[model samples]
Target: MAKIAYILLCHKDPDAIISQAEQLTAAGDCMAIHFDARANAPDYVRIRSALKDNPNVTFAAKRIKCGWGEWSLVQATLNALQAAVAAFPRATHFYMLSGDCMAIKTAEYTHRFLDENDKDFIECHDFFESNWIKTGMKEDRLIYRHYFNERTQARRFYTSYELQKRFGLTRDIPEDLQVMIGSQWWCLRRRTIEMILDLLRQRRDVIQFFSTTWIPDETFFQTLVRHLIPKTEIENRTPTFLMFSDYGMPVTFYNDHYDMLLGQDYLFARKISPSAHDLKERLGVLYASEGVDFPISGEGRSLHAFLTGRGRVGRRFTQRFWEAGNTLGPERELFLIVCKKWHVAKRLVDQIALETDIPCVEYLFNEQETPLPDLGGIETTLTKRSRHRRSVVRMLFEYFGKDRLVLCLDPANLDVIEDFCGDTAKTRVLEIECEYSDDYLIGHARRVGLAGENSPSETVARLLPPIRNDLAHESELIRGAGIDGYQRIREAADRAENEAAITEFLGVDADKAQAVMRLDYLFSD
Candidate 1:
């Protein structure tokens, strides 16, 4: 007799929501879906039309404009809870879900498990005691009042925060409530849900205080369920298996996650991409079937790591790559091959790869097609930030070991070249200026929608000298272009000795390669 009402909060993908809603109510359970007020009118209309005939399915009356990291999220959840209560009067428990979540377990299994447990399944962690917030802004979340949405309006959020700090302005939590944080997804006893709703009505002060705080949806019910329910009667965990990236965005599932998603222990897997039709269809069958539950793999390292990153060293590499700010560089010498033409640079890279045992990376800056024709990716390379450009360079140097890589630079990322080349300590700038920087500038202008801004000669005459001055100090200044430029770089790479080095050079061995690279970055500014 464990009647569950699943509250689904959705903004987009009506078809997926409809699919989930049908399966949910088909299992004899009820559902309340709250579509975001900001979502397309057509989408909302379509959802309502599809589910209108189902007696067990209902939509929340109030749809709030649910901005990310805003209090509106909690309000939407409350509205859905109210709708669920009214629509399913005999509900024994409430389960919070997102629109994109797919059930991995059969609906019958969920009902049976809930009946056996007979307790509120929710995560309620005291922030001070446990480190729950991965982004590391936990204390500030409750202690300060956030006027702007952190995710959407980062600059304004930080500005408001700084202003508050400057003026010594602060917000206080009520002494009666214990500040807690946890996942928003949960399954609560009907009594617990009713009590929380009643408390919101009676305690205007608490609601008012939480209204302006950042991401109150995470803490609002999380804190309350702990305050209301007895310790032993509640289970501090959620049934949904949700995962997020280092950037705090939810990890999306696709058609390829077929086996892992089906074999997972959780009742549901979250943030499924709209393109995941194959997996969704399979899960639909699983949801309706009376099949055996996947055995719980004993608690250990999880496959969640593979979901966000590539392989074994994924977490360590990501952490190292991003955290490296002042300490970003190769530990030894680096050979930097610079060119204005994409064809010349890519040609030299390929040639170098064949000639040497060392790692040769083409287009150190990512473009649509590094060695071939990818016009769109090439255009994106033109707008890429200097920091991102340099960060990847640092990542490669770190990954391959210093003096172990030869990176090719194209005018596609001209800013990174100018900035990086100025450092003659670790990097040796090898370039043959065949087309006087002006030729590259004019060609790039038309592609980037800047040709109309200035005539070719005027743009070059106004820019060439100063650009030359900036690069003159860094570049080796060889007077060659095209085929000659490619030939010159190849000859440089083929050499075994250098005037700057006392020892002979070898392609793979850094100890010997240092002779040809000559410059060391250890003391470089």
Candidate 2:
């Protein structure tokens, strides 16, 4: 029999933790609860009472207050693991999980998978810059250098500076090491856990140093594992499915987000929620009554249960029209236009030009100076002016027929883009429906091979030769319309030279030199 433990640090959402516990127990797994010391003891007692029926569950003796970047979280985890190991001595492996996390696979499957790997599945996400450390402020207390004693500080500074300056820590580190952020959950073999505890015991100074600083949960595991075992012994991926979104925490995990989960190349659909209830019902009905093998519609996709009966007309139309039309195909070169208030759009456009090789344009309508209207019926002068400006901008895009393939990132302005181009063939127009934080957007772009090194202007200029050739017959007409074609040619050459210089400075080869040379050839003509 395989034994697994869940160390839950319940702060605000005890119910959520309890829900996960119920699921884990149902899968015939043991769980251990570790309520934070900062939590109300009375509430903790009540929570403990609620789980009294479960013999596997037990409250930990030691409790710690966890804060961001602080050692409290690590201490709590270490304490929990110690208690769990003592309680479940015969257990083969120990798994760590968070309260907010939902399991996408059964405990049996996870246990078997871990046993097969014979390795510790702890993610070591490497980050080059330590700028995130500076942001560790709480209640006006600066915690960036929190746990550093004089000797440790000297060692850390020497190591960090050497890594950053001489070795170029950011660039030299492997992608896995550079982005060593684990899922805050891991499964470790009994031997590995023992080794970690033994290391902690021997290196009291290092452990004590970590205790005063940020949660260092990720770093501690990563650094220790690297030291103890050969790099081959570590499994970089985890079995759990983590669903993330550009906006807030993912409310539901779906088929679309499954690929993001690092490991488990072969994953069955599991952990169905209320969001999937409607899809489940439809699948259940199809499987039970119709005796269908796949239970999927003609298009190899099944209808989701959560969306059932919510938008009947819309759903019917989606099933009949949109579903088939929206099938994913081979990747294509895409230009994303995120529409917003005119100023915001302009700023984002500048950033897009600077950061991405893909050409992205921004269209903003509202002026920043304008005051927003109150919820009450009273209309402010600034609000009226802003509304007027938006109307004018909307009219301009409509008249120019530039609405296709343009998305409005602002929720308030999305209707405009949708109203204009929603029914159009998706081949020419695509809408990014999800809200994305800047970090998430950047990360997503990087993951999808969209975050290229070149700026939009540079990429556009490189591709301009083909575009110019296509319009060669109309060049005279274009020139007659007061466009300085010669000036553009000269500018492209100058830009190419400047880019080559910049690449040399950055200690990198110019991969786009041929593309740049093509522009030079166009200019020479």
Candidate 3:
């Protein structure tokens, strides 16, 4: 068996770390851990005691006093890596990981994947050229020097940068070195590790230089590897998958993210907190199921597809809109729903928003008092009419660009949405109809309290067809089941009013039951 060495950098949640180590450790493989020196003494003791019996697990002798975005982080990683290599000399590959990370694939599969792939697996890109941090924004970490603030225990101030500006103090890196940045976690071959260690001994200045740089843990190894190794020897990928929030922090996984995690191609996921114990337990159960393998190789366009297969109705619906919204694609889409009053389609809008990364906005034309749907903490943005038209349009174009799908929910507000989106070829108009002459439709609509002087059904039907014809070049018409549709939507909404009822009616996990209810409008259509 080919031995794999794991270097885990830990600070908190010692029990979680022990559990993660237990999952990954094998007879030949070893897990070398580096707990932050600043961590509580009790935590350190607990971690040591828990893993004391495991011969494959060893704690680093030299623990760095680690701080966020500081040189100390790089030090801690270096200590862990050196210790891992020293302890497991026969180890074929060295895998860097965080304490909070959990393997998505089985240990056997992970080992097989490492054995099959010859190239080093490290997420890398030129810091200057790539927008790895986020879309359209250049990273400032490379351009500026980040000095660690000992008092704050973080990189909150740039003391060196301030002094450099005032005193014109500058230190230039060697012209031969190219700056590279990426995720701190990686997997390196034994040869690669030896080469890295050799470089460290030969060029002491490289360490001195990167030690002062901002978030050097992300940049140091990448710069060294790119500088030393052939392009073909490196694969610019990491086995660990992390979802980052808008603010550039890793989005913590919870029970709600269980399905999402299973869908990803990566072997590991990070920052699985104590609150996510339920999700962790569920994943353990899932792994015990037959036919499951590591690296989860199969034919499907999405993670959702891989896990659930292509035939399930819910998966089909999610995949359809995900494709429509260009999920995990280069071209991101914004679904703009224009309305004067909250329509049933708002539920669909919210569903699409939750099920994908696409930004979905509901622009209420003149209804400033309209209540924004409680997204329950989904990052969907809802804008009222308080902002100026030009400002809002500019903002939309700035963020989502001209590539958008504009759904004209109310024909009366079509002009408003069009003006905001600046109607382009990327824009697709959609009209929804709700009217029916059938008595069942009328009676159900009245019984559900959706009928008025001008029923939602009649108003939508009267206003929609003309607009659909006008934008027929780039639009689709979605007709509801009149009163029957409203009745179904109301039923779902009533059940979804409470958490337990939603779970019972939708027959989905508690986290997704509400979302499933909101998607009732889509089913009714």
**Top model by lDDT, which number?**
1
> Between prediction 1 and prediction 3, which has the larger lDDT?
1
- lDDT of candidate 2 over 1-525, digit per residue (tens): 556666666665565556556666665566767888887777777777788887667666788876655677778888888887787676677777665455534455555666677777776544333332233232112123344323335587445434544553322222222233455567777788899899778777666544543446756676566667676988875544443332424345443432222122321233334454443333222212322112111110111221222222221222323223432222322222332223333443344335434333343333333332242322234344233433333333344444322222332333332332333323222211222344443333333333332223232233334323322323332234342111112222365664554233222356643233233222121
- The regions of model 2 sitting more than 4 angstroms off are 125-144, 147-181, 243-525
Candidate with better TM-score, 1 vs 2: 1
Tens-digit lDDT track of model 3 for 1-525: 557888888888877877777766743468989998999989989988988999888888788888776888888777777877787778888888887787766666666777787888887799788877565223445544557653583244646566666875656664678888888889888888889889889988888787877668878888888888888989998778776643656767777665446546676788686788898877655533446633222211232222233122221212223123322222423234432224545665676456544455554444444343442322233342322333343344445544443232454443343433332223333333333334534443333333332333433243334333433322221222121111112222345444344343223477775554444345242
* Collision pairs in model 3: 263-303
Candidate 1 structure, TM-score to reference: 0.59
Worst 10-residue lDDT window, candidate 2 = 294-303
TM-score of 2: 0.44
lDDT of 1 by residue, 230-338 (tens): 9898888888877776677888888866555554557888877788888888888887789655554311113344223322221222322533353344444555566
Backbone clashes in each candidate structure, one number apiece? 1, 23, 1
List where candidate 1 sits over 4 angstroms from the true fold.
Answer: 298-301, 306-525
In terms of lDDT, the poorest run of 10 residues in model 1 is 479-488
